[model samples]
Target: MQDNYQALKEAGAEVYSVSVDTHFVHKAWHDNSERISKLEYTMISDSNKELARELDILDESGKALRATFVLDPENVIQTVEINADGIGRKADVNINKIKAGKYIASHPGEACPAKWEEEGDDVLTPGLDLVGKL
Candidate 1:
């Protein structure tokens, strides 16, 4: 995750990590895990799960599911990924999605769909007028 965070940083994007763990546990985890300790992004501790609730990351079991949100510069949620506990979590994919978004943003008349790739055809401005074209 930190690796991806660093990549995003290199790309001139802001990144942050929010955890449901308490500040003490979050601190302990950071202190114990050498990998996470060197992170440049801010690690947010939400022991009360305020952010988890707001983001709807918590499942019916009352446990926060592994989730990811990609927000645009305006803080608008552009992508959301949530999964059951079995799936665990990975930040690389989300980082790639962010990269795709950045590319689309820079190119203007473009947008990415699920599982987008660099070479995929971006939506042209005129194509947008054809929305619902089957």
Candidate 2:
């Protein structure tokens, strides 16, 4: 996601990465790894397992699982995705999800359809019977 940081920010999203590694490990990777070195977002150390425990992402050895949490402005979790080891994440897909979330937030009573990618994309609205209650 480092490569798409600017795009994510432009989409009105703030990204924070939490890891089970120590602060020192985070710093070392940031200093030595080219990709990590280019990261511009915050990286939090969860070595004490505080966040991992709360999130219930701990593994057998106490390692945090790979997870993505999309939260609303009120800090309420809107969506969550957890992947097994070796699986990957896609920034563009997440960008679309964020866009759809923003659109839904503003356009009450309407919901984005499957494969919705942007603000002008097609959305699903309630029937006359449901009206604003949708």
For model 2, the run of ten residues with the poorest summed lDDT = 125-134
- Tell me the lDDT of candidate 2: 0.87
**Per-residue alpha-carbon lDDT of candidate 1 for residues 1-134, written as tens digits (9 for 90 to 100):** 77677777766577767777877887897899988788888888877888899988877866788777888889999889888879977777776677788888788766666566554555444475668862
Q: After superposition, how far is residue 95 of candidate 2 from its true place, in Å?
A: 0.8
In TM-score terms, which candidate is top? 2
lDDT of 1: 0.76
Local distance difference test values of all predictions, in order: 0.76, 0.87
TM-score (C-alpha) between model 1 and the true structure? 0.75
Task: Using lDDT, give the best candidate's number.
Answer: 2
